[model samples]
Target: MLLIEALTTGGAQRQLLNLAVQLGGRGHRVSVVVYHLADYNHRDHFRGEFERAGVPVTDVPVMAPWRRLWAVRRTVRAAGPDVVIAFLRRPGLLAELTALPARRFALIVSERTGKEGGRDMKDLTRFQLHRLADAVVANSAHLEHYVRTAAPWLRTRLRQITNSVDLDHFRPAGAPPPPHPGLRILAIGRFRPEKNFLALAAALRILRTTEPALDVTVDWYGNNFFLGQQPTGRSRPYLELLDVLRETGLEDAFRVHPPVGDVVALYQKADVLCLPSRYESLPNVVCEALACGLPVLASAVSDNDRLVRDGENGFLFDPHEPRSIAEAIRRFAALSADERAAMGRTGRRLAEELLSPATAAVRWADLVEQVVEARRAAW
Candidate 1:
């Protein structure tokens, strides 16, 4: 697999690492070629893990756009992979541009985002790159629909494969669950405009006023992804969100944490998981939170409606409307502990049925096998 990024901390990064290792263990020669070595917090760690597992690693330093394309072309030439899958848009474009010479290799383009997002490229590079890949992997059925509707030419190649969780690692240990206080809410993800942190803060503010001294604590743990990056408006989003907090006068109630390593424990501590993302294909955090037995309150967009059955396993609200998000929080707050636990139980059940890592690995392996066979047959 030719993944664009090597960082293991981000959602897509971690999934790529997991998929590479899992595929390697199953006797497939998996090689991950990253855009640059300087762009990761856990590079050495992922390198060591891959090395230990016998997975090949290639670091394609980002020189110029054309140079990066040449580097990808050279790497594909050297590795001679049976299948090349590019994650995210820019790299998917690069993979498409370079893989033309290596015509025997099957190219698979994967999109991790759903619909138009706050961080999505303005040029619609994803749509442009669709013609170059043999197949397209959409992380959710909702995302599949969106991509197919947007680019119907590739509808035959589209498939839905939700992000997965390692059941053994994320399952209940029979350890007594932590007792969460009243109105405790948690949201995890990079604090960016795409995540709509401002909307979440505003909703929390409304919840605070509905029941003064609601004892609500929204423990958010994530860093600004664009901090010190070339892209402008990185800090602006956080600043605007902080402005909302100050305006609502609930600045003191919010506990913003700089990104933490283990978020499974965070989900365990919270009564509810709230993801008010402006767009997403399928959020791994939502799946991880559900596996950890936390009911979700996510925006009614993309696969959220499919994953979160309103008032059943969890609730879905309009991401753009603070009132809708606030009302969902209020409803969750009104539920008894047993009722909340029941909701969480239903989410966990759904996760077990659909989002286990073993299940996802098997599905991906099957796809890889098919691609490999097709390549061999053509040869």
Candidate 2:
């Protein structure tokens, strides 16, 4: 059983869906239990895909917190899965609680973010509950270190499993898009403060003032709101970014787009992929961009150092400093066309070596089997 908050369009949710599909293909009995169903804009986003892949999805009806817990426990009991893998904090906590009474099954909880991402109280509670899990999965080495440092008790159970990219689908185009009049920059992710879209706008403003002759246009893709888990209705972050653009006279140089299904196409059309996030566990956008042979300019946070070799495949900068971002952009913009292409090729090689979906799935399967067999032996 694979448990998660929802099948939203976020990186973690998408990775969960991919793992479920791959696990099922490996001849394992797989099913997904979604905690909240209606909270997402594209509620049916991965439902049909799961169904077609022979994975049943159970939606736990919404109710009070206690009732929801009861419902999830009941659903798990009905499924009678040998092992339960839960993603995100809430699902991990619920899985720990659910596995207590039914100790026959193994429980694996995934921590997708750094310890600093959540409130102290919530992190403490999660750390306590994680002690009961058979194992804990961290998406990046940075996250694993964060968890171990915060709760030393998790040292034995914790394992780092980096997020995977569908290399076959995100492969580089036969040739780069024909050079255009201006540089085309692409940024994709949820519209949240941590993403620092406003900072990107600020950097662009600095670029316009310092290098007025440089022609660059940025296309930002992502939704203003997120569903499931942290259901947000606040459009203020996105609106503030728009306000910044207007104030900086960058309104004409930027465009905002909602999240799209064909993100590979966006990568193909873009000259460079920029991620100005304050922090991340293991950003899937970076993995996908590398797979698509696009050079990156991202914040030097989390596992970005592992993904990007400075001055090799891409450049990393201090996200807090708009001037640093502007400097990185200047560096990228100054590269010759052949130099840029070489950098992109390096990125693609890194993706193939580190972010292969097949490799990640095999690791997931091995961990699941290891835990399940250990539980059976103990029983």
Candidate 3:
């Protein structure tokens, strides 16, 4: 059984969906247990894909907190899965509570983010739950470090499994498309403050003033909404970004689009992929862009250093400093067409070596089998 908050389009959600499908394809009896389906509409939700892959999906849509726990507990007891793997915080907490006694089945909880503060109590709760889980998985070396430092008692149970991308689906284009009038840059992710979309807009404004002759355009792709968070009366982050673009008079240069399912097509059209995030465990967009042979310019945060080799496949900037981002963009713009293509090819090689979905699935299955055997040995 794989448990998560919901089947939204975030990186963690997509990764969980892919892993569930992959594990099911590997002859495992897999089912997904979601807390609610409030964030996504039917058109964009991944429930259909789960069904198509012969994986059952149980939607435990209870709104009340304790009721949600009871619902998940009931579902888990009925499913009687050999192993229950939960993604993110809420699911991890519920899975830990539901799989008490730890003797009946193995429990593994995966943490996707490395950010800290503003949730000390929540983090402490997750740490307490981590003590109950058979294993706690972190998706990057950076995230693993965060987990260990945050809850040193769980060091024995810690496991690292980097996020993966579908190489076959996100591969490079057959031939580079004809050059557009300007450089096409792409940024994809949620509109959270940590993602720093406003910083990207600020950087575009700087570039517009500094490099007047440079022809460059940025296409920002993502939705404004986030799950499980109350909306402030103030404008959302996406709207804030739009306001920044207008104030900087760079509206024409930066365009925002809602999140789309066909993201590979956007990658195919882009000359470079930029991630101006304040922090991340490891972004799926970076991996997908690299797989599609698109050079990247990401912030110097988390495990980005592991994926992007500076001056080779991609460049890193201080996400807080709009000037740094603008400078990196200028450098990428200066590269000749052939030079840019070479950099993209290097990124593709890195993706093949590090972010293949097959490799990730193998790692996950190995961990699952290890935990189950360890539990049986104890018995």
Q: How high is each candidate's TM-score?
A: 0.88, 0.93, 0.93
Q: Supply candidate 2's per-residue lDDT for 122.
A: 71
Residue-level lDDT tens digits of model 3 in 118-231: 438778788987888899999999888877887889899999999998889899999898887778999998777888888888887788799989998988887666443444
The lDDT values for all models are 0.75, 0.86, 0.85
Off by over 4 Å in 2: 37-40, 115-119, 226-232
lDDT of 2 by residue, 199-240 (tens): 888898899899989998999988676454344556678778
1-379: candidate 1 lDDT, tens digit per residue: 6667555456776677678867776787788888763442333334665676676777877477777778878887777778898887776777888767548888888877765643246534667667777788888887777777777777887877778877666754365466756677888877667898888887777776787756777878776544244323445676677777777787777767666656777777778888999888788888888888889999988788767889987889999999998888888888888898888888889889988777788888888888768777877
Q: For model 2, how big is the CA root-mean-square deviation?
A: 2.7
TM-score of 2: 0.93
Q: Worst 10-residue stretch by lDDT in candidate 3?
A: 226-235
Candidate 3: pairs in clash: none
Worst 10 residues of 2 by lDDT: 37-46
Model 1, backbone clash pairs (residues 3+ apart or across chains), number: 2
lDDT of 3: 0.85
